[model samples]
Structures are given as structure tokens and as C-alpha cells.
Target: MNELAAQIGVEVEPDYRADESDPAQSRYVFSYTVTVHNRSTREIQLLSRYWKITQGNGKVQEVRGNGVVGKQPAIAAGHSFRYTSRAVLASPVGVMQGSYGCTDLASQEAFEVTIEPFRLATPNQVH
Candidate 1:
């Protein structure tokens, strides 16, 4: 779809910590920064988003919401927008993949911009 030709880039950072109040439950948090470029000739509005998160134990969670962090961004042709968000999982490893629902302002046509999969790892991954 020409209307959905925009490019998306995602960067992820992982943070792990043991809960002081409950040592049995460790907290694994992953922060993601997303940049979306409007490569099409028309301006577009990001209306919604869909996310699929997979944990270390093969459990997958799907998240769908209206706008990111409560704000809908409109990008004109040749422009881009960036957002940062965090996801918390119970395991030290996981991956996230999804898409952004976008609409062309001129024609009001809807399309989806795909988000590439990114990894979340612990400190051990550095070795």
C-alpha cells in the first residue's frame, strides 16, 4: 500500500531488578523508542497501535490501544515522529512486534505501518 510506505524504527533497552518487597517476583522492564517517517506524499495521522509481546517462557501478550501514551501524532510528508514507552514482563527475556494504524489526512484512508521485532535481554547478553 503506497499510503503505508512509511518506515518505522524501534530501539529497545532492558532493565532488571529484584523487588525489595517481594523477592520472589522479579521485575523486567523494557523501554522502547519508536521513530516513524512519513515517506508518502500525503500527511497522515497515527490513530492506534497494536503490540505483541513474547516472554521467555513462550507466553505471548497482545496489546492494542488508541494512540501512544495518550497522544496521536500527525506527520506531514517527509517528516517523522518519535515516542518512548516501557513494557514490564516477569521474565528477563522477551520480544515485541506490532504495527501502527495510520490514516491519510487528505483522503481519510487507513493503513498499517509495521513495527519490526526487537529483543529484550539481561546483562548476561552483553557477554
Candidate 2:
């Protein structure tokens, strides 16, 4: 990872939405809140997103899109942007990982901030 990528931090908190999930029908709904922190001295804008989702049943899904939650947010130095998003899986357990495409506002330099793999599981699903 480049210096710009190293300066950005990504954190995710995932929850299983039992109300929206139907286990009998093999549908599992999960909501994850992500916070992107800009640790660099320069302002940065999130340009796009890339995600990889893997299910316990050995299924994988890849998603790529512009911005997140419908907006390309510009986060100032030492600031953070947070958003909540949803994902659906056929299995009760899964993992989600991705990267954010960002650009430094001052220099227009582009980089990717890694989003480490995080668990997505129903209550007591993973031990």
C-alpha cells in the first residue's frame, strides 16, 4: 500500500438483521456500519468502492460501484465519514472485505484504502 493508503483507516461493525432474514428460505440479511478516518494532513474524497463477500456455503460475490450509500463524501484532515449499508447472504455466516478508492484533494493523487475482512454471522453461528 502507498503512503496515502496507509494514512486512511477503515473500521466496520456488522450486525445480523434477524427481522429481515428468513433462515428457512436460506436468506440472511446483514447490516454493517463503516467509518472511514482520514489520518493524513490532506483532505480526501471517496471516489468508489470494491467489495468481496464470501459465504459459509462457499459462495462469493463481488461488487464495485461509485461512491458509498449514494454519495462521494469529502472528509477533511483528521475527520471521519460513517455510513451504514446492507448485504444479503444465503448462509447464516459470511465475511466481507473491500477497499475504498480515494483521492487526495490537495494533490489529486489517487489511492486505495483497505477494508479488512470482517465477520458476518447470526447469533451463536460462529464459535
Per-prediction backbone clash count: 0, 0
| Residue 116 Cα positional deviation in candidate 1, in Å, after optimal superposition | 1.3
Q: What TM value does model 1 have?
A: 0.82
lDDT of 1 by residue, 1-127 (tens): 4425444333444444434222246567667677777766788899999999998878899999999989998999878788878888777788889888888888898888787788876657541
TM-score of each: 0.82, 0.98
lDDT against the true structure, per candidate, is 0.75, 0.95
Error of 2 at 126 (Å): 2.9
Clashing pairs in 1: none
Report how far residue 66 has shifted in candidate 2, in Å. 0.2
Q: Least accurate stretch of 10 residues (summed lDDT) in model 1? A: 14-23
Report residue 2 deviation for candidate 1 (angstroms). Answer: 4.5
